[model samples]
Target: MRLLLFMLGRSIKPAVLITVFVSVVSCVMLTFCEKGGYVFDKEYDSVFTSLEADTAYDKVSEMADNTRAQNDDLAKRAGDYIAAHTKPGSTPPVLPDGLAGQAVRAAQKGGDSSSAGQSELYEFMGSSLKDGKESEQLIGDKLSGYKRNARRGVTDEYSLALSAVLTRDYEQVLDNQQLADKLYDTRAANTYLEYIENDMLFFVLIFLICFSSFSSERQSRRLSAFAITKAGAGRFIFCRIISAGLVCGVCAVIYCLLQFCVMCLSGGAGCLDMPLQYLKGYALSSYAMSFGGLCIAAVVLRVLLAEVLCAAMLLLSFLSKRNITAGLICLAPTAVMIGLSKSDNSTAQFVTCKFSFLFGGEGYVRVFSTPYPVVWLYVLICAFAAGALFITLIAQGQRREY
Candidate 1:
């Protein structure tokens, strides 16, 4: 324990100033440099005052039902117009002026008449409701048809079972109860999501702290000397890895708290006690949590992933003879992942994207016949990978040679 404390002390010393500087800079940038200034103070205040006068849930439900009905009417009219005017394999005629015409024009831009028409219909629906008008009633009515379509034409047992599980999950989310009394403000959550999505500084700070975890000792020939000590190389390496992880964890906590403080100061924290589903982009989520709970979960998951990254960095530091080598080895794949995340490849995006798990309810994966939360799956995979990396570090450290 003393050795661990000593190692932690050393690891934290150089990181203190860097972490503080980075956290402050990040907060400043998030406040001022973001597209819309921080806290969205004006918008938040306006919405809060409006919500205070009206029952927010009732307003949302009424608007959603109204908009959904309008959307269906527009879609049916557009379909009928296209079918009446165009023959098979012929170009669709210019639609007449109306809401249906607008929908048809929007769909024509995408080339594929059939799929694009449905996409445009939803796009129109989304735009109509984009201004802080969302509710379970709206989501339920919209997704009801989607659920039916998802279950259609599944002949194989595996596909049939998977579809059933997914449809059931969607049904549960649409029917889940949410806090009706709380008022939600999207400003703070939007700021938080935007900040985290572009948070390269966090990873950079972790890399700086852990990139020299063991390589510096090796480079200075202190590693062999430490191997001869009573603690031995294995114990020494373990202490170093643990200390790096702990320091990284502290940094993660500091970062999250700084963000939360910013949100509070901006008046966005009022909605923290509201249901997570009430947040923008999360109306379809199945997670049973409040906005505050989601924030806490995001922080916890981020710290876990940070520790996993710390361990991997330590392994590189342990194996590499120089700190620069360790850094390059760590950075190469990170750069690739970032690039892939920006590409149009769906599979690559799914693997490299952090947003899906960070902000819950984007989608789910099936495990056998059961539907599993993407956040849970991501955490489990990271936990296993961290264990494997730590085990490899220990085994390698136990070798006789430095």
Candidate 2:
């Protein structure tokens, strides 16, 4: 128990920290404008102007006039009725002793922060003042009109005008369009970046583990000692590989969960089920990266070289903006293997790449469709990695001298 606890203490702490950092960083990027609002600052304001510029202002102005008049009358009654009404042009209606306080309480509660509640009340007032049969017929007619308009792909201009009333500021139409565009597309871009980051987490984990584990051992001559031990080379190599890969996998899962949580919180449940294909691809890529990193580190034999190589790969990947390194590490070989082999247009062909590291690949099919050849290509890479690890183990076993 204590030994297990020690291992967990060593492993889970860094994993948790990495996951939290990824989540927080992602959330900040998502909430703020990154790379500027370049996409949104382009298209939507025109749509807003077309929908809302003219009719909205006139209706809101009319409503504002009516509301202002009502407020002014109420203020005048409160201020002038008791003091000036007794002697002036006309006497004001006297309120009952408790009526003013009741009205005050009603006003305070009635017009509370939510404007939706106030609008609902006005709607209720309008409904109540109408005849029941007429109201029912009106509702039926409106429903039919709504269906017809939906079929015709037409929008209600009055609703747009009413939106202006609710919004109050003419500029808000543009602001809302910007907000909607930002919320929809820019946020999606951030999520795409996040998916990339999350998919690349295995790579990050590999770098961290390779740096900390192998470099430390190499510096301490621990690897040299292990190479001379009874069965130590194989056991030590496999154990460290397993440990590092598992740690990376766990961290990837936590990061994924944190990212999904952020996505759900910010974007609502609509993003919950977006692009399953991309998610699958991401998972495939992530796992392949983790396992491939372990094999690469084991094969390289020099801890410092392994670290340098991994870092260089990552840096090059980011800088190149080409899909080559990403494809290599992301199990593109698997996609190749799946495609090059012959298959019927049957159930076997409809395999979904199940991976936890990256999101799914971006492909959709209604069964009988082969996943893209790219997917199989990544799988083949993973297979090659496994084969290389086996060869490395055999080579180490054949070496007589440490």
lDDT of the candidates, in the order given? 0.66, 0.39
Candidate 2, number of clashes: 35
142-253: candidate 2 lDDT, tens digit per residue: 4455456556755555543333232232233223222322111223333434343323333444444333444445445665687787755555544554454445446555
Compare the candidates by TM-score and give the number of the best one: 1
**RMSD of candidate 2 to the true fold?**
19.9
| Model 1 / residue 4 / CA error / Å | 1.0
RMSD (CA, Å), candidate 1 to true, equals: 10.0
RMSD of each: 10.0, 19.9
> What's model 2's overall lDDT?
0.39
TM-score of predicted structure 2: 0.37
Q: Locate the minimum summed-lDDT window of 10 residues in model 2.
A: 277-286
| Candidate 1 backbone overlaps, count | 0
